[model samples]
Target: MPVMPVDRRTLLKAGGALAAVTIAGCTDSPSGHASPSAPPGPDVAVAPDWAGFGRGLDGRLYRPGGSGYAAAHQLFNPRFDSVQPGGVVKAASIADIRESVLFARKNRLTCVPKAGGHSYVGASSIANGLMVDIGNLRSMSYANGVLTVGAGARLYDVHAFLDRYGRSLPTGTCPTVGVAGLALGGGMGVHTRAYGLTGDRIMSMQVVTADGVFRPCSPTQNADLFWALRGGGGGNLGIVTSFRLSTIPGGKLGLFILKWTQSQAAAVIRGWQRFAREAPTSSWANLHLDARSDGTIAVRAVGVSTTGSATAAAAQLESFIGIRASSRSFSQKSHLEAVRFLGGGTSSPRTGFTAGSDVLRGPMDASTISALVGAVKARAGAGMTASAILDPLGGQAAKVPTGGSAWPWRSSLGVIQWYVGLAAHPTAASYNSARSWITSGHRAVAKASAGGYVNYVEPGRAIQSYYASSFARLKTVKRKYDPANVFHTPYSIS
Candidate 1:
């Protein structure tokens, strides 16, 4: 869902990614969005045509050059840095979200809502259009083990809040990721195999449709929209205001990491194709290999299991990989600690990168494995880091029948991600090179992968890869919810 942002994915269910920063300098507003004492001059984008749009809301608005505009305008992926919104409405409440939708109709301008700003391909942004930022709409409550998360709540907020109650949800690793965005796209995480995806745990949501109406959706209420909301891509059907998610009790966890040299990488990967796919639902494993500038392939196998002790997890690891690991370590940690570690809590990870991933029915063929290793080494020689991962998707997640949700990829054994690094603020040369490498890497993986992950979206990809057989059904719901093409982006349900 959040793609669990970091230099690589933080390992979703660990929690998810961060917001991007820019060099543009602007003073922060002295007041928060919920405060009503704020001035109004800069709230309307300084246009007579925009004044009513601002007055119709209880939140603050930022024009291109308004105070806090620079801070609020940054997207998670800088690939679309050229696409600047005409204005950003920091919605203060559900009412503000409804007003923004109606305002978009009156102005005849495209309006996109942004929460947590982590769309992998900048899907939440639009060029010269209105952006309804729900950053200020964060207010939450938990009753009877159900967390009613605000549309604007981040993964960090959810984790911290749930930690207080010893409850957890399978989600992306990045802490700053928007809860609504992740669940909307059918979130996956280490806990997914056992507890199911973030969306799977969702009991209900508050959505603002194209008609500017706020309504509650669930299996029994607004059923069609609820079906679409479970796995329909974000900003596609309607603006979700709140999510009532069922949480699982969390406790101490056993974490395992096994590392091997390049010579052993293949054997480990070969074993991964078999064992990782079959690991216990309470146990999830991932394999990571990076092409280092030193021309060496760095391979590591990591996992978390809720069903066993550290020693038991280690023994399970031994059986998982028949070959002895060159280095192995195991630790006992609280769920929050382990989640943070997997999500990359210690880095300046919010930077630019090109990511291409694939959904596979099974493990990679022998040739694809060789090609992947070769590709990594080749990219490393080019001074670009090529990182790939084999993330398992079975366990409880596979129990949901195909078409049970809009995600429609229950047959997937796992996903393979190949991403090339670019500078936080990359040069044309660096960006182009990373794009080239990712393209080449993507092609190699496509030999086995039938589709791509929606959360880690790539530019210009067909919707079939992400939604598969669910695309047509998704389209029907999209048309019903947004017949005027109000909630749309480049790859939106069309």
Candidate 2:
């Protein structure tokens, strides 16, 4: 039977109404309830046996036509607009994942592995394929300071779980980002300065390979596969079921936010470059410059340190900008709190936003910074807020051996992220500005950096440029793992 088409306006109206109702009275408190609804997209034909596949060995299947399917498809990134999978197999156990992969391989259909659904590029969750939704695989076990988390688990959940034992890992700030994609793609977060990317902390992984075989991977066994899994990007190699991560003792961390005006943009950026290079590994900073409504520029300096003392870190960072703060938000927060602040708490829904990223080895000159700021200032709109974020690299990030993993940008000083939000219809002018800013900003920063971050790439750019030096090796791995290129997406090696 052909699937019935729903009007785009109707879908939006329905989704908005449902969201408002579900989130109406919910507070931003950590204990607030999460609304369960299907992601906004056209309805697709689900297989007749979708219900059977949804059932676990325990006999409970979550079906797309059922209530659970609606809730299960709601992931963190909202840009993905394709239909829901023909069917969703909500894997409640590792065995379920194995069974689903085997079934999909035998049937000769495509399969997309979904963790937290936080894939900004929409690769984590797919449309019209066998969607192996892994949200229910939320088991966590800790022993001897090593934490083992299920792939379906979210970063915030891991933080809360480990916090009980006074331990933590270097995961990204977005609480909802899946551990599978982030860890597999070289996660960068608040603790990266002190501990390194989340990939560095991974001790082992329980993976379902492309051939439908289940095995444990680590540095000693399946060593080549282990290298590929770390920073090689997810889904291509296999479905990662669980991860064994190294954890550290939790302690107080300092968090500070300093703001500046457009007039001080050049000075602030130059100062940031010097500080990022010289600051101790214990200290980390992020530079955010957005356009204001009144036609002025706004620059915010955010930083965190392993040392409990904010005084020194703040002073060292503040001196570089050499500008008085228009506004400041600072606190001494636990690792969890720091993660929440950096991730932009639950109040801000991840909706209608387009973001792209690049890595920088050095700093942009004053003229480039000025032009970039002007582009952003002239393009502000209701749903549109264009800005750039610079995340410091080096320290432990560079210590990993060259060719140690597929992650190529170990020597990078920081990552440059360009993003814009859209509330209403995106006009040609708005899109043009975004493209121009991203291109110009990337080129301006590229003089200092060689390439871009794979996870944050926009559509239409060459994959070769994104991978740069590591493309050859990654392509070889792609051939070994996915020889037929069955698992292709925006940034797949193939």
Every candidate's lDDT: 0.69, 0.63
Summarize candidate 1's per-residue lDDT along 97-140 as a digit string, tens digits: 88888877555567687886766566677666778998776787
RMSD of 1: 7.0
Residue 116 in model 1: lDDT: 69
Query: Roughly what TM-score does model 1 have, to 2 decimal places?
Result: 0.89
The weakest ten consecutive residues by lDDT in model 2 span 1-10
Q: What is the lDDT of residue 171 in candidate 1?
A: 80
Cα-based lDDT at residue 127, candidate 1: 65
Clash pairs for candidate 2: 38-70, 54-61, 55-60, 55-61, 383-421, 383-423, 393-413
- Compute each candidate's TM-score over C-alphas: 0.89, 0.83
lDDT of 2 at 289: 77
- Which regions in candidate 1 have their CA more than 4 angstroms from the true location? 5-8, 11-48, 78-81, 346-349, 401-403
> When superposed on Cα atoms, how far off is each prediction in RMSD?
7.0, 8.6
